[model samples]
Target chain A: MIEGRYFYPHATRFVAARASAASGMLRVEALDGSLLNEAPAKSLRLSPALGRLPARLSLGDGSHFESDDRAGIESLRRELKLRAPGGLLHRIERSWRGITLAVLATAALSYGFVAFGVPFIARKLAEATPPSIAVAMSRQTMQILDGRALAPSALKPKDRARLEALFRKVSAHEPRGAGGYTLLMRRGPGVGANAFALPDGSVVVTDALYALAKNDEEIEGVLAHEMSHVNHAHGLQRVYQASMIPAAIALLTGDVSQVSQMATVLPGILVQSAYSRNFEQQADDDAAAILRAMGAKPSRLGDLLLRLEEVHCHKGGCAPSWLGSHPETAARVERLRQETGK
Target chain B: MSGEHEAAVESGAARSYPFQFEGTGGEYFGIWIVNLALTVVTLGIYSAWATVRTRRYFRGNMVLAGHAFDYHASPVRILIGRAIAFVLLLGYNISLNFSPYALLVWIPAFLIAVPWLIVSSLRFNARNTSYRNVRFNFTGTLGGAAKAYIFWPLIAMLSGGFLMPLARRVRDYYHINNHSFGGRPFETEFTGWQIYSRFLIAFAMWIALMVAFFTFIAVSAKFMPHGKAVSPNDIAIMAPLILMIAFLEIGFIVVGIATMAMIYNLALGHTVLDGRHRLRCRLNPLVLAWVVITNTLLTLATLGLFYPWAQVRYTRYFLGRMALEATSDLDEFTSEAFGTQSAVGEEIAGFFDLGIGL
Candidate 1:
């Protein structure tokens, strides 16, 4: 008769088996009290004794089996070691499930925001823009406002020739007026040094801005930038947004009275209607590309930006009029410098 | 020795089985179901408790040479460890977002955080187990944890593109060099580079098969006589859909078989120096086939209600069939105490009445 321990680490199970050999007949009983009748000449055969336990065997008369009462099963376990099995999927399954759930939850939450958030912000911005800034005027109305005679007066031949050349050069780019953009450069009294693009893409530059330019490159750089605002349809987008505000408010409240209430805050809205930093950067890049295509040194824009910043800094509290409707001079200067690689 | 034999003869003593078997196969399913239910109800708070319960069951029921294995973990300690990990993760995220130079702060933070987590896990595992007047202690190295984190993710990404052979390499890598209590380390002589090439070949073959499948569908659709307004556009859309479904079905089968193969490879890698402690698992193609078929049918039939049950059955069958061999000194006996406490266990027990005498 022989007795020994059998360890199975993966299942975390341990078993003890007893065998008896006599008269060339051997009978082996498993730890769970099940009997095994078959014993091959040099092998041990197991039976399905324990519920889920599989059978095992040993060869060569089982001479390696030992019997000890003092040591107990624990000591036997120490002598024969077993390793626990590890699974790759089992380890990472929880993490994968967690990430997947989080992504789904985030998507569910963000769906509501996308459905309502963007339009709401756009409506608020539109309510802020002034109607006077948004609406366009007829060419006849503009001529009447300028007090021009019904019959135009003849101009001096040299002055007329110069005026025609200027008009030809300006119109060659074919600046579209779908958004009611109109360029007006004039030498007017009390109109300080300035050049600005209105929400309607109407670029109004004073004669002082032409005098401030060191050469035609700087003048052309400013012209190209204003043209980009028109070409890119930024003005039309603004007007459409300005019109959408009251409509959205009406949709939300089902009342038209709020539109008048919103009109009182229009000036404050226009004061804050500056383009986003990304938009300004895009305009600067476009201007640099256009000026370069027109055979001009794009850095001339950088020089103008530096002069504007210096003037704004010297004024301390007050900025140059051109600095309005845009970022601070320092910021614009840095952007232009980056664009022109200066 | 002769005297001992004579004593045995004189006393008429008979040899007894070395292990104590008190396990009931079906009881574990009940526990698994219950644990799963509790986890679902508690919204994952039961995870820590479940871990403790699982460790206790597996340890308490294991019978070796008439002695039972035992393990106990402090839930409070585990909870505290998790809390610390959460705080560390938050700090790491903050640093990543706010630091001017992330390279200076974020990388070190991650390195420290990962090692801390690994150490905590090992400590928890060690403090949970008790055996024969000696409590188990964890002695994991930080270097190992770092290596595991760095290489495991890379392996996951690489295997996604080259699944078949890379899967084998990953299995072998995990099994190799795994050390146990009896000074037995796992062995795998295969290299990853060799498996990578084989995976590339397999991937190419799979792509070719996919192309052929699409071509067959296209050719068949083109040859069919038009009864109605059959346009090439219609064929184009229908062909892709049919090919997609066929591809998914075949992919599931391949993945299922590959999973089994990886398991078998892992088992083969585990071996003790004395040759007694060993494990050998054979990939049962029929078992994998049944899993794929049953899962597909269940998805079609119960609309996923039977998913949990299918999962439990699959796990039970695979685990039950696993075979282990050890030296004569160590005994093998299972007890109901080791059964997991989760909802899946109950469902399994209800489906298959193994009556694991709990």
Candidate 2:
């Protein structure tokens, strides 16, 4: 038997309701003992139980009974053989053992997703993005950078043309044979000694970087690295990866308010950094392969990288931007030496 | 037994009823952890369902005048709304990828849409919440929302923030005045100037903190030796003092507690439901700040596993102090079926990091 308060939809009052196996029905009685409702046991629906809150059982006529009598609810269910499919969720929610197992499972799954799943998915998505979208993204970035931090090339006309020819030679030897690749020579005093690839296959070689290289082969090495970044769509992948941060944060906090502020700030930070250590290594490996195809020693790029690091690392502390965002130069040079059989 | 209680309430016998929240930290903690586990297990696909279940638990646990409040949103509806919001977000990202100039158009367009979005969100939420099975309703106009959300904030900004109190008043009035339960409107009688009077305490606290900070700096400069070179003894003596000053500076921000508490107290104190029911909020700023700071520390220490406890403790502290003075019998209010509302604008506003007006 079960007893609880019943609320009819049309009235703002409570009626007494009772159900019994002997009667094989549920009935509601008004305050003055008049019959308010009577329905067969099969005509009622039960809301899923959540915590210690009252359980609500609704009849066909829109009136519902709310009760916290756990024993009575269980008995009623057993009498009717009500096979609640949500028994699994209810069991897991009610027991300490199930909750402990869930917590551990969730922890392991989240760690795996963050450590391995997200990067792999980002890489695949980047690879699948249309080349035209990548190119447009790169062009827009270059225009914005030019307006802010870049100027016309400060090197002599002959020097600029010579490097341009070297860029053309490298592009020709590519598997796609100069597939929409453009090389721009520009002075970037603020971003000293840097080479970067835009998503659209445009590589910018700063005057400071060109001057920093000891020989044409060294400059060729840097060009090869930049080309690899463009070909692999690293920039686009980085942006896409940043877009997932809020989702990850939401999972961690389980609160909507906590992840809201990250939507605006996370994208800016991701775009400024080149990418992860794995991305940097891939670019380096590609640069070495390109140098080998050209019959030039791949060690030249490593030598240039070491020199650049030494120049930037004045007084034993490297620039914050250099050491923080990018991988260690010493490690990359060591890897390059191994590839070159040095 | 139920009939006798109903009669006592109808005889114009007044009572000072304290709102009740029966949710315990341990009970809610289980629900919270389970919700989180399932949300992660489903790769966020089940978050909409999780949201509904969480809302239902909290609302169902709250009892007023012998009846519990209820939330009637469907998980499928919320999922569809969230999907729409995510698609819009992707479109915004694509625009950013296309060109920086898209920002020129996007910012203004986003601002213009804020009022309409606020209205939609309020309508969606109010239409879904029910007490005694009668759905609450909101009828504020988009134009009124625009004036409250945009124009007043702009005027406040233009006036060097002196008119911020007025902006808050405008927003509060818009929220309270438009709310109704079964066709009876909520009435708020407080004015902008009244809010400003309460705001003066916060403003004064800010000025005093600034003066004290500068004074401390001046005193330190007078006593300390010049130049960057300092002895180890000097460093040891100054470090603790500097740390203490930093702590004091953070403590000064507790004025935020004062400001927020005063706003809620004043606003709710003047708001009348059905022109008969009265609300009283008696929150103490120091106590509130203590709860906030300790809860934050505890949640951080446990790496957010303790969040459910912290949330429950905070809610119970705040709601426990609130009371409703019943002038008429609450049992007389009958339930009327209302049309369903889509959760799209609520989810979209949530995506944009805007608070849902309560």
Q: Pick the candidate with the highest DockQ.
A: 2
Chain B TM-score, one value per candidate, order as shown: 0.56, 0.83
**At residue A271, what lDDT does model 2 achieve?**
34
Each model's DockQ? 0.03, 0.27
lDDT of each: 0.46, 0.73
Predicted complex 1: DockQ: 0.03
Docking class of 1: incorrect
Summed over model 1, clashes come to 39
True contacts kept of 1: 0.03
What TM-score, over all chains together, does every model reach?
Answer: 0.37, 0.81
- Per-residue CA lDDT of model 2 for B1-358, tens digit only, reads 8587557647756566788887888887777778778878888777677777777788887888777888877676566655555555555665675677778987787777777668766866676677776667778898999899999999999999999999999999999899876666787878767799878988888788878777877887777767765543354655857776876666675777778888988888787777667777888977887877677666766756677787788778888888887766556533222212121121222232221222
